[model samples]
Target: MQGAIARVCVVVVAAILNHPLLFPQENTTLPDQDKELMARMREHEEKLEMEQAKLEKELSQLESKQEESSSEDGYSWYFWSTLSFVIFFTIELYRVDLTDTEIKPVEDEDVFSESGSVTPRTMVLDKDVLSNFCDKCMYTSSHENWRVREFVEGFADDLLESLRSVCDRDADMEVGDFVGIGSMFESWKVCKPLMCDLIVPFSPPDPYSFQFHLWCSPSSDVPPGLQGCGKIKVTKFGENEKGCLCGSANMGDDMLCLLHSRNDTPKVDHSPDELLCSRNTPFLAKDQVMKWFQISVTKAWGRISHKYDFEVTFRNLDAAGALTIRFRSGKVIMLNIIPVVQLEDTDAYFVSHFPSDCDSPPDPYWPLSFAVYEKNLLKHFAKRLPQNSCHLHCLQIVTFLHRKQTGLTGKSALTNYHLKTALLHLLLSKKPSVWGVESMEHRLRDLLSFLQRSLQEKRLHHVLIGNSKVPGDVQVPLIIRKAEPINLLRPLVLQRELHAATVRHFTKC
Candidate 1:
């Protein structure tokens, strides 16, 4: 150790002497300050030489057996070694802190986007250091990602295959009886894919029909501009559900005769306020569809070999309607197969039901979802982007911190899905160059600031809505074009006390 220190000092001194910054030409003029600085450098060099000499003397003493006897009399050497290692590891993780002072925040515009975006200032963070930190996180998270996805998705495929085999014989189902339609299927998810969102589309027997419903303030007249809610209209009602427009005299001609028009099948007793469709009460009831999935999927899962090596067995199906895929290996994932409706043009009806819905609306039209389109939009935007674009790293970093501070739960105001939407919108606004890895800190600050502004304003336009900047060439519903911006953070905004709480959360920073 003494010899290594001596060699390091020699190299540093040699480099300083050779360094161009240290030299001044004979003809060059120098201020008194410059002269004093140069003198200080010379003194520093001399002091280093003296220190090196003292180190060598100590090394000589240690080489002698007398010093060895003194070392043996002290505490264990590994104690100091472990302490040094912990310190080294802590230094490496310094950048992971959200409040790292190197990030210079850009000012956001309070007014709507008129001309340009918030221009980020060039930050002075060490490029190599930031890259190293991100690389380390990504390496470990990638491994955890695979285990959850592999186990969950493998089970999903087998389940889907079983549904296909049965649906082939069961003439009542077609086109929409699918499951597991969200983020778990995507490759960009980080850490372990802890949760899965499954959407089993309700295939109401034909002639019953379905139409998309926009939850616009239960008022008698809707605004012409349709602000606050979206359109879900042929563009809405399923092709077969759109009768006469599907180039057929009867849209139900090819469909099964399970229409409520006939009295052959008895109607299941339901409460009057339960939002049953007036035209077809028996066939396409949302609650009944949910009940069917709960029973059938559970039965199918039970018939499969349960005592597998990985030990994935039939966990109970949720009462409200979703299949829960549990794992005996580890509590790494929570998978749910949800029952949903597939509208040709699904609208933004439930922006108020964020985090998680507090109340179930008495509507027969099962609210539609745009999970498929969102994934496609992200996948397309990422195609030409550089591998290390901060467009991704910003999200990965923020999400890592978010999970640490709170968690990946619907109970919180923040969510990974919201972050994903923010990134998509930013991609639409900013040029590709702005998302480079070098701009990570600035980009991340920008996203946080944007979210902060959204929370304050109580307005976060749905990505599927045509109001915000939609990505080029991505098809969206026409109703989305006419929809007014909704207050997605309304629930959070309603509580005055939460403002202080939100401020505290934002300051984590």
Candidate 2:
């Protein structure tokens, strides 16, 4: 019985050791293997608890970070949306202001009479006022039509101011002067169309003419009509010796008209007859002689003629002389030649005779005659060497004189004398052969020698050197400084030669 009790007690002790929490003393007193098993169970429980706490903490941190990131993104989106709304509202308000601005149609009274009466409707503008208005409108208005009108008006005013400046600068020149005429044409060409088409209300009359009748006022308030007023008349020349009829009259200050045929009345239309007529006379008819005048001026200035050989031939005996000028192809004049001569001084004559210049004077036997001539040798050369050449030659001659006065040598001397002589000889030879042919080569050689000696002595250098304020110590060689002057005598020299030759040829024939 006691042995049975001992075995039961051993089994009880083993169970106690295995159940670690049931008996602490028993577990401590257990064998090494049982103690190690109890230690492993405690370690596993601690690791499981730590793992659960760590996962919970990480999840909480992720939730807080996500909430913060969402708040920042929402704030940025709200700010941009609010800013865009403000910008859109501001642009709408500005556009509304531009659209609401009023533009009154041009008044009829503003255009017609110099009396400040708004009678017949005509289009006119105060250029200074219009320019200012245009500047404001260009930046302020979004309307395309208004913008275009303003831009055009501003451009026209600017052009007019420029023209006025030019005129003021050239106030000393007469209407007959080429420079004056050219300026007038340029101004008219630019301004007339703008006035008729866009700004001015008056129906453009026939071939237009601009007459400077009224003096411009310095006061800004001066009426445009009174500031530059002049009459536009529609006149018809009578048959034979019967003067002309002034049919229609228009108010002044600014006399601008469009040329139209009488048949077309107030409307502007291109009529070949009117064009042809204007080519012969400066009338308001659709036909105008001014067109031809314009063409002739361009041709003369440009030196472009269909007839390659066109020339002026002068024949003189003692105090009296005859001048015949013609333009022709191989041997035919495309148009008639008209000639006029006005004796100015013992040494001078003013000739205005060309189909391009005037109508054939009544009598074919008028002191000056109009004739068509075949292009001959004289005609050929004259046309080839333009009037400009004569002026150039004159300048060269003056240069030669100057160099002769200053006796400089080597490259400088050769440049002044030899080079100039060669150029002068070339010019003279190119001139009509009728001009005297006697001893040109010998004369040129002597002139060159004289120029070289003059340069060495510093005699004529002043003439060639224009207003270059180089100090005397700075010795840059002098050169021909400006365009040569075109004098009346230049053309006459060639004319005289041709006349003499013609006379000799006719007499021999």
Candidate 3:
């Protein structure tokens, strides 16, 4: 046993001496060339190790540089600029690309006119393909829309009827008409026709009413969060016996027409002197009215929901106190029942959750909403469209893009409402012939180009508010009318580079 152990120990010692990993010293008895070769191999390993460490350091530096580059697209100086428009209606639409010092000048727009197309491009998907695509999409959507409309009309009739019966107890809490709105209601809906907009008019407490109020400078008392925007107020009131400013003269016609399109002037004072405002209304919290609406609307719908097969849900109360209703059948139907007042003779409009004012009382009543009048204008645009025109098609496509990219609704910034505002501007700027089928692709490009230019200027002028183009009777607040427009998507410019991509693809088609 001792002999066997001794032999094994000797074998282990020899193996350790022979092993390259465990033994550091090399055999000195080798030839000179072999020794030189081994020295060269060791030098080679040392070089590899040095190279790897250097590469690791360089990789870390590159990663940091990439992170910094990513942040550059996050902001632009245009966001903080003051809005300006020169006297000529010919706008110098431009962009200040932060990444490039050299900008490609836009083709001279001075060459174009309302009556003619721009220098015709060798654009693809020309007239025929575009017209056919629009038709098929419209045809596909119309049936679903008809069914949804029929269902909603039935639902609204029963709902408003129930509201009228139970709402008699509280005069201020009473809801007036139930009118449908939005793209779905207007029949321009594309892929998803699941939502519906309904206007539910609320009667204001006597004497007090909603109007546009602009804040011109610092020291002006505006809404709590809106102190930074001391530019203009779209709200204004005229003198009357009840201390109420009727937009008719008091209710000024054409004043509120910019936000939404309307032809008829206001004829009646919805709230007259004999109908006194409620003394019980709260001053500080207009939300109290929203609370009133939430309870009154939900309970009112409860009495009527049984008549329809769908489930009625009061999803949320918006900042202005508008109530959102979600109807669930096989699909979802979103109904926005907004309380509003159309200004008397002036034809301006206001919503129930009173717009926050600068000079007015700290407490609020209904502000203003122009949804109905806006939709009314949409109807006019729809009716006048040439056969298979791209106005509705273009609107639907952009609207879908807005919803998909932002997951937003009309209430938010860059809403379908804003898109409509852009469309209205284009409609008014050019002749109906300019929106013909052959010009569909260019018209779409033109709208996107218009938005890009406006964004770069940091001002998307409110259509209802005063600007270079608004009517005389339309009294938008000086500060609000002139204040820098909201740059809601300033930080998100990259997430939606789709506008350029859209033009590129369509032009190629």
Question: How many steric overlaps are in each model, in order?
Answer: 1, 46, 45
How does model 2 fare in lDDT?
0.30
Who wins the lDDT comparison?
A: 1
TM-score of each: 0.58, 0.15, 0.51
CA-lDDT, candidates in order: 0.52, 0.30, 0.50
Global CA lDDT of candidate 3, please? 0.50
Per-residue lDDT tens digits for candidate 2, residues 1-509, read 33223333443334334332432322333456786777876676566556546655655665565544355556654555565556556756764464344223345433545644222122232445434543453323325433334543443344333323333221111112111111011111111111112111111223332221111213223233221121222232222344323235644535443533345443244343432323333322211222333333333423333323455333221101122334354321111111112121111111222222222222111211101011121233345543422322222333433344333321121232233333333433333442332333333334444443432333333211232332232222232123121121222234555434322221111
Q: In angstroms, give how far residue 323 of model 2 lies from its true place.
A: 35
Q: Give, for candidate 2, the lowest lDDT window spanning 10 residues.
A: 177-186
Candidate 1, residues 349-445, lDDT tens digits: the string is 2211122333433323334356676776777777767676777677776677666656422235656766677777777778876777778877877
**CA RMSD (A), model 2:** 36.9
lDDT for each residue of candidate 3 in 255-372, tens digit (9 for 90 to 100): 4533333554432343321223233422223344455666666777778766666566655544322333344535666555655444453333444432212222233433334455
Cα error, candidate 2, residue 65 (Å):
99
From the highest lDDT down, the ranking of the candidates is: 1, 3, 2
Residue runs of model 1 more than 4 Å from their true location after superposition: 1-130, 143-151, 163-182, 216-288, 310-331, 345-362, 407-411
